[model samples]
Target chain A: MVTDKHYAALDQVLELAVLINDDMTRSLAQDGLTVSRTHLLWELRRRGPSTQRDLADALKVSARTVTGLVDGLEATGFVTRQPHPTDRRATLVTFTERGVRTVEEMERGQQEFARLLFAEMPEERLDCFSEALGEILIRLREASRLTDPRGGDQ
Target chain B: MVTDKHYAALDQVLELAVLINDDMTRSLAQDGLTVSRTHLLWELRRRGPSTQRDLADALKVSARTVTGLVDGLEATGFVTRQPHPTDRRATLVTFTERGVRTVEEMERGQQEFARLLFAEMPEERLDCFSEALGEILIRLREASRLTDPRGGDQ
Candidate 1:
């Protein structure tokens, strides 16, 4: 049975997630960007230049959806498509200079947010909180894996 | 300065949110529902019944979007529209029997998930973890409010 405290904690986490998402949406909208487009940009930042096919597989989205997202990002000047270095039949998506700077700013903003949350927190309490979060993440991942249909054979 | 521990905790929270969302999406797919549809159902369950205008206001979505979601839910037999008792121009969206049962199941599942996460935890540690979450939630909300354009006048 879940205690009232457990329920409270769970509610807090969910509310925080929703609030974080709303904040992100609003922030991204200022740049005329959507979450899906930012996600594509992030993938490019992490993977360097990538083909649309690879991006589709990485995002678990269809080729058409990836194409649409790439088109939107390219139009927004965040990414550009070029002929693959070797594969004549394929095009690679890469971040523009502005895109790199924007991604770096996003990373800096995330770090600043974390600092705002934890700057005044006691070191010991922060440790405890981190451990609790780490443990919960492990358990949640295991639970999700168990329920995931694609993992049914595992 | 934010420590590596802070970054790890934030990442864990974000990853947990994404995983939770993925799990919910998969579960709702089994019921032919999307997150927006479920949000409507949840609002109905909490508010008893609501008009499309009211739902749009509560959800911060457009009236047309709410209508589309309600139409989909009605087609699935999860909800139905009834004429308002006094307001001739208004119709209230109410859940069907199946809808009520499904909402109850969703609520119970949430409690079960909380229990699974905290059942084995020590009471003292749980208290500490809850306190940490409560504190962070307070800070996050304030931060979001400060950044919210709608709250600028405040």
Candidate 2:
């Protein structure tokens, strides 16, 4: 039955996630950064200096949450808040020099990691895998939405 | 490039995990049960009455964690402790009637979920997908190991 196969794949997916998450945590621990913080940095690097409100919107988190993350990152010397050049009411969250270096290094590391994971696999199989992942993601979103308590509102 | 494809797949996988985890949390919250407690119940249903120590080993968690979970489950009427038949120093963690039903329902729900996710996919594609997953998982584990600071110990 596909049930067994599905469960086996799910098991692998869950384990892979755990491995990936643990690896990220261990590596990030060295820099005193967390997943959320790393995400913020990556976003900043990609989008350039962004206001806290803009970051909150892009990250799909609350303004308060963004503020807290920025505060923590600022405290840790990875980011700083500067007065917006064009708007007095707005403030920009800019990366420090070290922050730029760190994000670039992390980006390179991620690329290398992805390459190592997929480089040897035949392109045809990688295509199939990518297709399968897309299909699964669609169903997973539907399933999550169906199960969500605030389903109708979303 | 395969880099883009690999990244697309990774993004999907990460989003899928978030969706799955959120779905589970929402569903479990309805029953006043967290994931770990449900795991304990499921394990109890599968293995019958088990000692807390046995559960700790099976779940790969510390004894203190098991004790806390069992205590919480017991307080919530999902499980109870009984002195082990042969070992005076050990106690068995057995599910209550409600616990049994809950775990069975969760198991059924899991099966249905997997079926819904995979039943429509063609067998050939599913085979390829499974193979790709296995290969990806191997590399993921290796990557995690390589990045892990305590690599040599494992």
Task: Give each model's clash number.
Answer: 0, 0
TM-score of 2: 0.85
Candidate DockQ values, in order, are 0.69, 0.58
Model 2 misplaced stretches (Cα beyond 4 Å): A85-90, A146-154, B86-89, B145-154
Candidate 2 C-alpha lDDT tens digits along A1-154 = 5567789877776676666667667767756799889889988988999999999877768899999999889999999999999999999999999898888888787777678778888989989988887887788777766666555223
- Stretches of candidate 1 off by over 4 Å are A150-154, B150-154
By summed lDDT, which 10 consecutive residues of candidate 2 chain A come out lowest?
A: A145-154
Task: Please state what fraction of the native interface contacts candidate 1 reproduces.
Answer: 0.66
Best lDDT among the predictions, by candidate number: 1
Model 1 Cα lDDT, one tens digit per residue, B8-92: 8788767766877776677777577898999899898889889999998888788999999999999998999999999999999
